[model samples]
Every structure is written in structure tokens, then in C-alpha cells.
Target chain A: MIWDWGFALEILPVLARAAVISIEATLIGFALAASLGLVLAVVRIAVPWTSWTISVLVELIRSTPLLIQIFFLYFVFPKFGVVLDAFTAGVLAIGIHYAAYCSEVYRAGFDNIHRGQWEASIALNLSSWTTFRDIIIPQAIPPIVPALGNYLVALFKETPLLSAIAVMELMQTAKIIGSETFRYTEPITLVGLFFLAMSLVSAALIRSLEGLLNRRTTR
Target chain B: MGIRTLVAMLVIALVVIGALATQESYQVFMPGLLQGAVLTIEIAVLGSLLAIVMGVLAALARMYGPTPLRWLATVYVEIFRGTSALVQLFWLFFVLPQFGVTINAFVVAVLALGLNVGAYGSECVRGAILSVARGQWEACTALNMSRPQMLRRIILPQAFVAMIPPWGNLFIELLKSTALVSLITLSDLAFKAQQMNQNTFKTIPIFTLVLLMYLAMSLVVTIGMRLLERRASLGLARGKAA
Candidate 1:
């Protein structure tokens, strides 16, 4: 038989546990991306002199493949006296890599804010912090939520790359299972289905989030 | 100009020059890496061509083909797009042989990456075609052009320009994805770097060279696409074309 139902059923539990690691990595990495990306975006905007250097950094990170980035973090950083474990390195690599892409999205979000809004905040005698926190970010973020959500899904897909560093995520776990049982079909197919289902679910959720934001913004 | 920028620049320069300064070590690594890069470029180019063809075909099938073909194309896009390229690569490389169908790793790499990128490219094609003004389609109908003739002679040329930048992005993406092909035991640059690292334990130089090579390749794609876009839009100059 091409696919053994019993074997698939037997391995489902092991794959599910590993999937939690993948999900945890995605959530934590995305949180880092979302936050670090905002900092990178804000730094680029606020520090006019630093913009050139920041952009070059962003471009450098963005252009290189994430796998190499992960490998570099895993393999090379120890030479510089910074050591990180496989999972930590994988998550950090994923976080920093996506952060570059996310910063661009956030920068675009910040750009859409009208100049008058900044002027109004200044006219109201608000501190820069108050202006950004109370006025600017709230406005800037809603429009870009959908864009950020897309990255969330993108980051989830990238969780599989962590397997390269031996992070024991779903993909790596499945690979191990495949090697152990020599049944690549079931474990790999299940992992693919899990990804497909999660992506579809997240996509639908993002659509609803878009609808929610649109209605709130329109009001 | 600032200290931070200077420091960053200096660090990068030192790393790069440090890697090159040692001629003995450079000789050890550079040749193997360059050979791997050639293979990487070959796969990327072939994969990109296949992606463009599959993209245009799938986009057309989804947009204007018979209902079943449309459904098939949609499924193709969603399935391929939904899964990570790595999974798709492993499946083809490992699983397909179970059914008594075995292909070489290089063919598997190209097929997997091409089809995967093609799924995303179909959307680019669809978006570009949709962005072409509604009036163009009307004019084609008014001229009594057949469906294929209208798409071929009238609709596509205009959409082709809009598609270039997005296709350029996809091309770079395809290039980066070529790195994944290394995972399937193909001797691409990434694979070569990993191999050399294992052998020589010179992580810094080998990986740095590989990263720089990829960055250079992506920059070339970016520049080439910009030139193509300029050339494409030349005939469609706004006032002149009208």
C-alpha cells in the first residue's frame, strides 16, 4: 500500500507535539519581528542621519537567503563570542530576517499618516512620545495590520527552516520519522496538510481582521 | 558619515578583505564556491523560465479557461503556495520513488522550485492582467477579435509591462529559493559552503563569501529588471502612445 492508514494514525501524536514547537517558534519569532521591526522603522524615520545606514542594513538582511542567515547565526556567531542554541538561533534568525521585511511594511504604514496629523500633535503641545504613542501609531498601525498579518503567515511557513539547525520542529520531526520508518509519504504529507490548513485558517482570520479594521476605520 | 555607519562599514570591509587577504585559504574555498555558484545560477535560470511559463499558463487557465481547468489551476496555486518549498522538495525527492517513479535530484530541485514559484507568479500575472483597463477588452470585442487573438495581440502586451516588476521580485525569490535546492544534496553554493565548513571549519569565510555571492546575484536581477521595465515602457510612452 502506498499509504498506511495505521502508521499515519500512529505517528499523528508525535507530529502534533512537534507542531506545537513550530507554532511557539512562529508566535515568538513574529512577536519579535513585529516589535523589532517597529523599532527599526521608527529609528529610520526619526534619525534622518541614520536613515542611509539603517536602510543599507535592512537591504543587506532582506536580500540574503534566510537559510544562510540561520546557518550564520548557528555556525558563525560563536567565533564572535556569541553563542546560541539551535532553537534560539533559529528563532532569532527567523525573527531578525522577517524583521527587515516587516520594517518596510511598517515604514509604509508610517508614511501614510498625513503631515497635518504630525502638525496637529505638535500644535497640541504634545511631546514626541505622546504624539507617537497617542496619535501616530494608532493611526499608522491599523492600515498596516493586514500587511503584518501576511508576514505572520510567511513566518509560519518559514518555521520549517529551523529544522536545518536541528530544532526538532515539525519538519525535522517528520524527517526523523520518515528516516526511522522509511515512510516519507505519511509524515511529510501530514506536515504539508497541517501547513495548508493553518495557512488557510490564518488567511481567513486575516480577512476577518481586515473587515474588522475596515469597519472600525470607516466609522 | 557617523561613527556607527563607519564602524559597520569597517567591519564588513575587514571581514571581506580578511577573507580575501589570505590567498592560500581563498584558493581553497573560492574555486569550489564559484563552481557551486555556477550550478546555482543554472538551476535558478531554468527554474525561472519554467516558472514564467507555468505562471502565465496557470494564470490564463484560472482566468479564462474552462471551469475544470480554472479549478485545477486554483488548487495548484493554493496547494503549492500553502506548503513550504522545502516540504515540496523533500516529497518529490524522497516520496515519488515509492511509486516506481524516480528522478534525479537536479530535476527534482528545478521541478519543485519552478512549480512552487509558478504558483505565486500566477497571481502576479492575474493581477497584472486585471490591472489592464477594462476598455481594452471592450475594444477587442468591438474589433471582433477572438478570445485568444484579443489576449495575444491586445491584452498581453500592456499587461506584460505591469508584470515585469512583480516578476522581477519573483525571480529574486526564485534565486534565493535555489539555496533550498542545496538541502536536497545538490551541490549549490549553500551546500558547498556547508560542505567546506565541515571540512575546513572556516565558517566565517565560506559563509560570508556565499552570502556576498547571493547578494550580488540578487542585485543583478534587480538592475536587469529595472532596465527591462524601462525598455518595455518605452514604446508605451504615455502621450506618444496615445
Candidate 2:
């Protein structure tokens, strides 16, 4: 494959702009997932009555493909009077999709919190909310930071699925460039490199965060 | 029954009723979706088989082969694992043609899925092998066993057990990922769903049905993997007993 420097230079600015949208989608979607996942995990643990429903909902979300979920939100939801623009629907779909996975990570962290910690909180007569806030979550979250970071990287790679709904993400921009120039190598390869760089950087960050957390726990 | 079980049952019943209520649409769309579903299964099965082969070879090369081979394996794993699968698929489908290599869509799907999942699967293989314990290697050496013999007879059998669950996950992930092939104009389940939606304008039922179809396929893969895992672990238990 021939590498065209001039073509690459021309497309760099457009691809960079699209990359910003991709990064924003990943960050926003991840934020939504983190909070929603925590809520799901907490509700499942705290309310016995809702645990079954929540678990089923999580499983259904996890089992289905994210593309279908995005399409359902973008296309089907409009018929149901819940119209969403491509970016909003894409982010919401991604957020909800990853929320299922994130909740499982949160659940694992919650499960790792020792029973004695809970009983000790009871002995101290702390409110349940206070117990979770003070005793459980602090210990639980540190270990899961690495796992959560994985989903962040995964979510970043998956942002291209938004292009299916016509969100002007990096992948879509590359496709447009390819169609216009009829030269696929440079634009697609650049997008791939962008993803690889982000993934490696995120992984390194997660590793250092894990090390920091471990040192604090040991100290 | 527990209240939890009752709630789950009620949800299942509602889904069943909803599915059945759309019997007419099901008749119209079922044939196309079923055809697409078959293609999806074909892609998953063929892709996973290719992935397992690539994973084993790459893992071996990375762990014990020459430095150049090790670097090759590492690069393959990192590049595939880091990038978007859609980009890879597009690269193969769109870009390869420019290089005077035009593979059909199905072959492109299989190659992309296999290579992508193989990248992830190699890690599972490498991890399982490394976890087989240092003493086992020493013992094999002490017995004057060759590297291949030791790996095939002692190491891989045990590692196979450990690999099953993660491989199961990879298989399901691969199955879900096959949906992306639809974007490349492969007429897979997702493509058929899109086509049906365009024709019928029954967006909710059409997409819902396709979603359920995918879920059903994933469930099947999961159940099959569980059975395979049980068989592998059973052999492990039997080996220990003997």
C-alpha cells in the first residue's frame, strides 16, 4: 500500500476534529456508565425486592449487541415518541451498554468487601448509607480501578459503532475520505494508529493507578 | 417461589407474549432473519476455529520462539487488540482492493473476526501456559522430556481447562461482533433486520426480533461452552483421581 504524505497531511485536521468527538463520546459515555453502574450494583445489593429485576435487566443488556441497542434507541425509539439525535442516541446506547458490564465489575468489588466490614458498621450504629459511603465503597473501588479503565479503552474503540447511526466520528470521517479519494490506506491506518495510541496510553495510566492504589492499601 | 423468581418469570412471560403477538410479522420476516442467522453462525464458528489455531501458534511463538518471531507475535496481538474491529474490517474490505487483493465480504468478515479475536485469544493461551507452574517444567526436564512432548502431554492438557472459560467469553464476544459484518454489506442478521425495517416500517418489532435472535444465539454459545468446560474439567478431575 502506498503512503501518501500530502493526502495524509490534508486529512489530518478533519480526522483530528472527528477524533475529538470520539474522545468526548468515550468520556461522556464512560461517566454515565460509571454512575449508572454504581447505582445498579447498589440497588441490587441494598434492595432485595429489586435484585432479580435489576439482574435480569443487566443480563439482557449484556447479552445483546451494542449495535442493535444503538439502532433500537435511534430508530425504534423515535416511533415510541422518544426521538434522539445521532450523537445523543449513540452516547446513551454506549453508556447503557457498558453500564451492564460496569455493574458487574462494581458487583465484584462489592462482593469482595468482607462481611465483617458490614457487621462492624452495624456495631458502630452507622446508617446504611453512611456504612456504604465510609466503609464499603472506599475499600471496594480501588481494586476495580484497573478493570473500570479497561472498559474505558473498550468504550473508546467501540465509539466507531456510532458511525453506523451517522455520527461524524473518526471512523465515519475516514470512510468519507476513502470514498472521496478512493484511497483507503492512509485515513484508515491513521484512525487505527489513533486508537492504538489511546489504548496504550490508557493501559499505562491504569497500571500506574493500580500501583498507586496498592501502595496506599499496603501503607 | 421466592419473590425474585416470580418477578423474573413475569418478565419472561411478557417477552413471550410480545413475541407471539407479532406472529404475522414474524412469518414475513422470519425467513430472511433465519437466513441471516445461519450466516451469522457460520461466521462465528469458522472465525472462532481460525482464532483458536492462530492463538495457539502465536502464543507458542511469543513464549518460546526466536526473538524476531516473538516480536512478530507481540505486534500482531497489540495492533489487533488496540484498533477497532470495524476499522480492520473496512481496511480489509475497502483498502485491500486497492492493493490488487479483493476478497469477498464473507471471507473478509471471517478473516477480520478471526484475527481480532485471535489477538485476544493468544493472551488467554499465553496466560494459561504461564500459570502451569515452574516446577512442572523442571519435572518435565528432569524426566528428559522434549519441549513439544512436555507441552502437548503435560502443560496443554492442564492449560486447556483454564482456557475454556475465557475462550467461552471470547466466543460469545466473537458472536456479538459478527453483527458488524452487516455494515460491510454481508447480509448478516443485523443487515436483514435493517432491510426488513426499511420495507415494513415496523421498527420496534423488527429490531426487537433481531435483538432476541442475537440474544438466543449468544445463549446457545454460552450453554455450549459451559458443557465443553464441564467436560474439560471432568477430564482434569479424572486425571487426578487416576
Candidate 3:
């Protein structure tokens, strides 16, 4: 196929414009995943039955493929009277999927708390809430910054899943432009390049965050 | 918490799912759910097989290849690991078709998934191999075994055992990722679910069924993997347990 530099250059604006949607989906999805994950982690930390049930749900979500979940959500939820829009469905699917992963991150955060912290809290006549808020969370949250950042990076990549639900994300924009121009090489190459650029920047940012966290921990 | 006591609760959960599934127009949803489940399996299996092969190749290149080859492998790993899988799939299926290399959706989906997961799995493979200890390599050389012979006889068996657990974890991940392939229009579980949802307009019932089916399929595979892990861990010391 003859490569069209001009065509690829033209699509750059279009793809970049659509990138906003992808970023939006990612942010919304991450927000949902973060909150849901924290809720489940808190429940798991507090109640055995809640934890067990949540574990089963997490396992189920984790085991099955993500594309399938997206499909189920986009295609099936309206039947029971919850008619979600493409964007909502996409965000919800991404949120639920990543929440499973984030829960593991949060659970790890929980696990990293020294046993003595809990014992000390009990010894001090602290309530469970006080123990968690004043002691456990402060200790547990720092190490998790890097892991949660990685998940955020992952969530950004996964925004293209929103394309399956017909959201006009970055990749979907590329596909449409490519088909419209009948010049795939340029647009496709640009997409790869675009993703590469984004990933590199995000990775560097995560590393810096890691460094910052490390410095804080040492102090 | 007792076996008989919890049985009622477990039954209730199943009943709830079933009840939710059928309290609306649902017959069409079952076929779609089953279809999506099958597609999910096919994509997961094919993608995972590709991932294993690519992973091993990638690990080897990273481990033993010439400088440039190792560099190339590193580039591949970093790019894939850093990006979202959905973008990769869209690029492969839709973007490539515009370039006049119109591959089938299934192939595109599988290749995309394979390459994506392979990048991650390569790390697992490398870690597993490295964990095999420098002592083993030293021991093999001390026995004066040929390099290839030593690798086959002394190192690979242990490495293979270590590879299985990591491979299983990657497989579970790959299974979940196969849903992205539906964007390419393959009649996988995700595609079927979407189709049925569109036709029936009973989205909740249909999707709920799909979720249950996926959970069931993944649960079975996970349990199977656990059993394999057990068998590998115990080895032929079966009679010791017996």
C-alpha cells in the first residue's frame, strides 16, 4: 500500500481530538474502579462473609475475558430496565473490570500493614474505625501509590475497549479515519506512534511518583 | 457456615441469578450467552497458546540473543506492556484492513491478544528461568554434560514446572481480555452478547446470563489449573499421600 504522509498528518488532529474521549472514559472508569475497590477492600477488611462473596465476584470477573464483560454490559443491561448509554456502559464495564484488579492492590495495601499496628490499636483502646483511619490507612496507602498508578496506566490503555461499545475513543477514531481515507498505513502507524508516546510519558510519570513515594517513606 | 447450612444460601444465589435471567424476555439471551461463552473460550485458548509460544521466544531472546535481538525484544515488551490492549486490537483489526491486508477478525483478535499477553508472560518466563538458580547450571557443567543436554535434562524440567503456575495466571488474564476481540466483530461471547442484546432489547437478562456463563467457565479453568498445580507440586509422590 502506498503510504500517504499527508493523509496521516491530516488525521492527527482527528485522532488527537478523539483522544479526549478516551482520556475521559479512562478517568471516569478509574474513578469508579478506585471507589468500588476501596469499598470492597474495606468490606473485606471488616467482614468475613462480605470478603468471601466479594472474592468470588472478583474471581469471576477476573477469570472471564474483559471483552466478554464489555459485551454483556453494552448489549444486555437494557433488558432489565437499565438503559445505559454507550459511554456509561463503557465506563461501567471498565470500572467493574479494573475494580477487581484494584481490589487486589488495596488488599495488598491492607496486608502490608504491620500486625503490630493492629495489636497496638487494640491495646490503646482504639475503635476499629479509629485504628484504620489513624493508623492502618496512613501506613498502607503510600506503597500503593505506585501500584495504583500502574493500574491507571493500564486503565488508559484499556479505554479503547470503549470502542467496542461504539465510543469514539482514540483507536476507534483511527479506524474510522483509516477506512474513510482508504489509506491505512499512515493512520495506523500514527496510532501506534501515538500510543507509544503516551505510554512513555505515563511510565516516566509513574517512575517519578515512585521516587517521590520512596523519598517520603525513607524520611 | 456448615456444609448443609451454607447449601441453602448457595442455592439462593443461583436462584437469584436464574430468577433475574427469566423475569423478562430471555430465551434468545440463552443462545447468545452460550455463543459468547464459546467464543470467549476459543479466543482465550488460541490467544493463550500464541502467548505461550511468543513468551518463550521473547524470554529466550531477552536471555540469550545477540544485542540487537535483545533490544528488539525489549522494545516489543515495553510498548505492549505500557499500552492498553483495546487500542492494539483496534489497530490490528480495523487499521490494518484499511492498509489492504484484510485479515480475518478471528486471526486479528487472536494475534493481538497473543502478542499483548505474550509481552507480560515473557517477564514471568524470564523470572521463572532465572529463579532456577545458578547452582543448577554450575552443577550440570560440573557433571561434564553437553550444553544442550544439560539444558534438556537438568534445567528445562524444573523450569517447565515453574512455568506452569505463571502460565496459568496469564491464561486467566488472557481469558478476560478476549472480550476486546468483539470490537473486531468476531462472533465471540462478547459479540454474541451484544447481538442478542440488540435484537432482544432485554439487555439486563441477557448480560446477566453472560456474566454467569463467564464466571462458570473461568471457575472451571481456575479449578483445573489448581489441580494441575497440585499434581505438579506433588509429582509422582502420590503414594506418599496415599
State residue A47's C-alpha deviation in candidate 3, in Å: 3.2
lDDT of 2 by residue, A15-130 (tens): 99999999999999999999999999998888889987888788678777899999999999899798899999999999999999999999999999999999999999998789
lDDT of 2 by residue, B1-242 (tens): 23344344445644763675569856677788889999999999999999999999999999999999999999999999999899899989988887889999999999999999999999999999998879989999999999999999999988998999899889988999999999999999999998888888988777877887777677666666767876778735433452
Query: How would you order the candidates by TM-score, starting with the best?
Result: 2, 1, 3
Best by DockQ: 2
DockQ agreement of candidate 1 with the native complex? 0.64
Answer with 2 or 3, whichever has the higher lDDT.
Answer: 2
What does candidate 3's lDDT look like per residue over A1-219, in tens digits?
467667767778988898888888888999999989988887888777787788767766676666667766766566557788888888999899999989999999999888988999999999878887899888888899889988888888777767666788887777777677666667667777777788889889989989999998999
Q: Any idea what lDDT model 1 has?
A: 0.90
Better of 1 and 3 by lDDT: 1
lDDT of each structure? 0.90, 0.89, 0.78
Listed in order, the DockQ scores are 0.64, 0.66, 0.51
Q: What's model 2's overall lDDT?
A: 0.89
How close to the true structure is residue B56 of candidate 1, measured as C-alpha lDDT? 97
Tell me the spans in candidate 3 whose CA falls farther than 4 Å from its real position.
Answer: A71-83, A215-219, B1-36, B97-100, B144-147, B235-242
Give the per-residue lDDT of model 3 (tens digit) for B67-144. Answer: 999999999898788666776776677667665788888888889989999999999888878878799999999999
